[model samples]
Target chain A: MRDTYQEQLDELASGLADMCDDVARAMARATTALLEADLQLAEQVISEDIKIDDVRAAAEHRAFGLLALQAPVATDLRVVVAAIHGAGDIERMGDLALHVAQAARRRHPQTVLPDEVKSYFAEMGRVGVELAEKAGRVIRTRDLDAANELEADDDAVDDIHQHMFTVLMDRNWTHGVSAAVDVALLARFYERYADHAVAVARRIVYVVTGQMPGPLAV
Target chain B: MRDTYQEQLDELASGLADMCDDVARAMARATTALLEADLQLAEQVISEDIKIDDVRAAAEHRAFGLLALQAPVATDLRVVVAAIHGAGDIERMGDLALHVAQAARRRHPQTVLPDEVKSYFAEMGRVGVELAEKAGRVIRTRDLDAANELEADDDAVDDIHQHMFTVLMDRNWTHGVSAAVDVALLARFYERYADHAVAVARRIVYVVTGQMPGPLAV
Candidate 1:
């Protein structure tokens, strides 16, 4: 039974890690859709939101299943709880992307992306995907160093986020309300993406060290 | 040791429950301050927000302490998790009130609540206080029916909130942007208050059933 429980926990982690990967990809794709004014991509993301929700519900059910059936103890309990939390964070990130996509759709088709800010968004997208992959790697290896590294990557995302804000606040773009809303919503998406990724890293830290790493860890 | 653990859990729940009672009152007081434009009352609520924060932190710490010490299983674990979630929800309710109090202070030294929406704010305030009180009662008694009542209360609050949109959308007022900001911000506070109260009820359901409740239970 213990072996079966351990296997269940491992399988659940694997599923969650894959779901996180897809969540990250969806966010990146949504950003592309927004920037490129691709109506199809935005609509796709809106539809894909159900996938995120499905994964979130599945993660919780799997965790509770392990809890009720195996009465998992020790590391196994931590694994189940961490999976639940990670799934929740990932789902929130999906919601953030949905918000951004909606704002973009409301703006109609697409607005031209600012050059520096576009680069920043692209870099953010890359970092987000990287974090998702690293989260999966940490789960596979239970590697403290891998988890710690993912935590550190959050700083790079934040740095670019600050740059994005600076671009928005710069006196250069004094145009329309749509521009302001688009920029604000995009910033929210990036900030929340970084936040959710860091949360996964924090859960990994908790699993190993039994303490949540604070902002200082970043 | 097991008996002592149970004793501590009860004591912690009682103490934290008292803190929740305090938060519910502060939220009510803040709502009253908004409806009456009572600067003094608003100021009082603002000052008391620190006490609410103190209680929130202490409740979280106490729950975490119990979790770490007892390493409780099944029902006990659910109880602690619910308490932690309930504490955070109450804390957010306090935050929404503080936002209102800050607005009241800005309107300052004068009764600035628009006469047109005074009744609306009053009803909102009333519903918010009543719902919060019911949530507290449900927590204390672990009564599912009382907890279920919160969902109905939330619907009532939502109805008032939807009506607020019609008030804002009314072209008759011909108010400027500042009035629009005030109206929107006020609606947000009421909407958020109802949300947190519903969260408390949801936690009650989680505790009683050892499973997450459906949307109706909220």
Candidate 2:
């Protein structure tokens, strides 16, 4: 039977995985809100971000209690510390999704993306959700191979982000500067969301392997 | 006489302060690089960012060691935990500065900012530096009043960020879509730099008072 200390550690891991799932759902809905110009869905994402924050606060409190009470060492210590950092990254992922939703609401009744770039955003959204869900799986299973996969998934998001700039800068582009600015910021939101998911995956790798794969590209 | 554990805690606090100063310097130089179109200065900021990262790594190592060896509780545990979080926030501030520098480098031989918005960016740089310096002070001194001041300073950056969008969308904007995108992203880098500075301050407040001042506005 697992001791209470081990149980608490297991709970922390599951809690972080659950937070990743929450943000994944948030990103999926946020993407729909962006693509469909669905004001109601956007508002739902904007309001529900607090639930992610609540999970983060609870994870931090639980980690703190474990650290103070158990004084966990070695891998256990790394797990608790990684939980604290992972919670922060996942919370930021939620914030990035919220930003995407807010961008959608800001342009409601007037789609933020031009017809030309909608497909690009749709692809980014799909990849972003995949990244978030994979990050959760990485955290739950401690599968280093899965954690490493997030880097490639993040590269896919970065490629889309780069392609977006090319579209914005093309001479054939017809969207005004305002729309261009909105698209640029929105692309960034997606990119950062993927980056945070990758960050969470990296933290889990550290917890299991005692080594960070590498510094994030920044 | 202070035991080695107490000395380690003090060293961790001062190390975080030093990191805040490092990022502050990076931001100031990055702003100069942005405003003057100094390719050399921009390159300098980009390369020197690793030094900030080094400090962050060291701080994290020290904190982890303290947590494992000392098993601190209550305020000491909070202090060590806050140092880890603070280090991350300050390192992100450094990354934001590097992004600003990269923006400048990307537009080398051509100033990134048009004349109309130069003054606004200059002001942001100035205020951003002030916020970083104040955050360092807050970490070192645990001054709650000083920590509260960061919110107003961040507001100043936000106001400038909002105003820059208005300028970009103005009927008079003649810089075209590319320039508008550059300026939008630059403004966000500055605004986020200020936000991280505030995040560091809030973490310091939590260390001292055992209460987070509030959630940072996403």
Give the number of the best model, judged by TM-score. Answer: 2
RMSD values for the candidates in order, in angstroms, are: 5.4, 1.6
Error of 1 at A23 (Å): 2.1
Question: Candidate 1: where is the Cα deviation over 4 Å?
Answer: A1-3, A72-75, A110-129, A145-173, A178-182, A215-218, B1-19, B22-77, B84-133, B152-196, B209-211, B215-218
The residue-by-residue lDDT of candidate 2 on B60-172, one tens digit each, is: 99999999999999999999999988888899999999999999999898999999899999999999999999999998899999999999999999999999999998999
Q: Tens digit of lDDT per residue, candidate 1, span A1-218? A: 25576678888988888887777777777788767777777788888888888887787777766765666655666676677668767777777777666755765655545554677777777787788778767777778888878766888887876676566545675533334334544764676677777778777777777666763111
Best by DockQ: 2
| Superposition-based RMSD of candidate 1 using all C-alpha atoms, in angstroms | 5.4
Docking category of candidate 1:
incorrect
Q: Tens digit of lDDT per residue, candidate 2, span A1-67? A: 6458878999999999999999999999999999999999999999999999999999999999998
